[model samples]
Target: MKSKNYDYYLIILTSLILLAIGLVCIYGIIYYNFLAVKPEWSSLYAEYIEIMNSYLYPFLVLLLISLGLCIPKRLLGQDILIKSSALILGATLVLTVIFNLEAGLGFILAVMIGIQSMVLIMTFRKSRAVRFEKHGYVVRLGSSLLHLGLVVLIFNFVTLRESPSHILIFWTGTLLITAGTIFALYPDRITRLWYTEQ
Candidate 1:
């Protein structure tokens, strides 16, 4: 029992630490890749930066909510968190589908929100009692969905602007999406060969 409790603590602590690192990296991406290249708000880069900035709150909320669940909790709170996460993701995914089909002002928003939804959905699913759950499951699945969505979105965005450079982004995004999906779907098999007797 003590060992199991210790394992739980380790998992939560590790997750928290990684979450912090991811937040920093996200901010760095915004700061260095987006904000640093701009006349502030005049270009697509600016729009991307602004959109990423919007994710700060959601990311923080997710981290906090995950922390809440990492501790002992009443069933009500767990249910609330689980359902709310799912709802948020589901709503965003629906919006993404709408945006993808409609051709409108919210293309970027749709893509980003879609990615967010994918992440939240996978996170919620992993937090459940699935024997298949593991460290990379949620992130890999979410990233795969996000990558695939971005491939299409970026292709459209770049094509609309008549740019050739973005083709690299498209290919890389597809590769990442494919790799992530492979990992998410077959993590146990992939890692099994790496295992040695404990």
Candidate 2:
């Protein structure tokens, strides 16, 4: 039987979901920072922080679910899946230690990274091996770009509070996200010449 074509819709949907979440998080962080400076907003800030903290776990869960859906069907084999999962977990652990991440939030972040990494690995493997149809190539490239953008945004989010170069990081993340969006939405127009050869 011929292999099933990739689900471009699912990839785009998942990327949008992730981008929405990242934007929400960035907004929350920036708003919180702004509120911290004003004495009158103390009560409001506290409430906002409480609400964000309370919903964090559920949000992480949602992110994981969306990311899980982005994984290609080709990577569903038992051995490859296990290996990919292990690799993700190992990398997450190492990063957590190196960064001195907090216990609770760090664990959640690690889990999120692990899940994203698994999907990314699967996507990369499939895109490399398969000679995708035109739409398939676009979907693969778009999804990969979006994933890369999300990773940058996540890193920015994590360090937003503590980093001295906050403005620089913020701009970097924004640029990445913009580029990803462009790539995802206009893959055909953007790569028509190069992709024709493939």
Alpha carbon deviation, residue 57, candidate 2 (Å): 4.0
* Residue 60 C-alpha lDDT in model 1: 40
Residue-by-residue lDDT tens digits, candidate 2, 1-198: 123423465456667766767777987888788888887896787788766754454454345444433332333543564465456545644654676433333454445545445555655566454332335555665555565456546555654557787668667657756765776788778678566778
Indicate the residue-level lDDT of 185 in model 2. 83
Off by over 4 Å in 2: 1-41, 68-138, 193-198
Any runs in candidate 1 off by more than 4 Å, and if so which? Answer: 1-114, 117-161, 193-198
Best by lDDT: 2
Q: TM-score of every model?
A: 0.31, 0.52
lDDT per residue as tens, model 1, 1-198:
343564486467758766875876767676666555666645566666556545543444343234323322211244554575556445644654575322322333343444444454554466453222235654445443544444454434533445665666556667656666765677677567446433
Query: How does candidate 2 fare on TM-score?
Result: 0.52
Worst 10 residues of 2 by lDDT: 66-75
lDDT of 1: 0.48
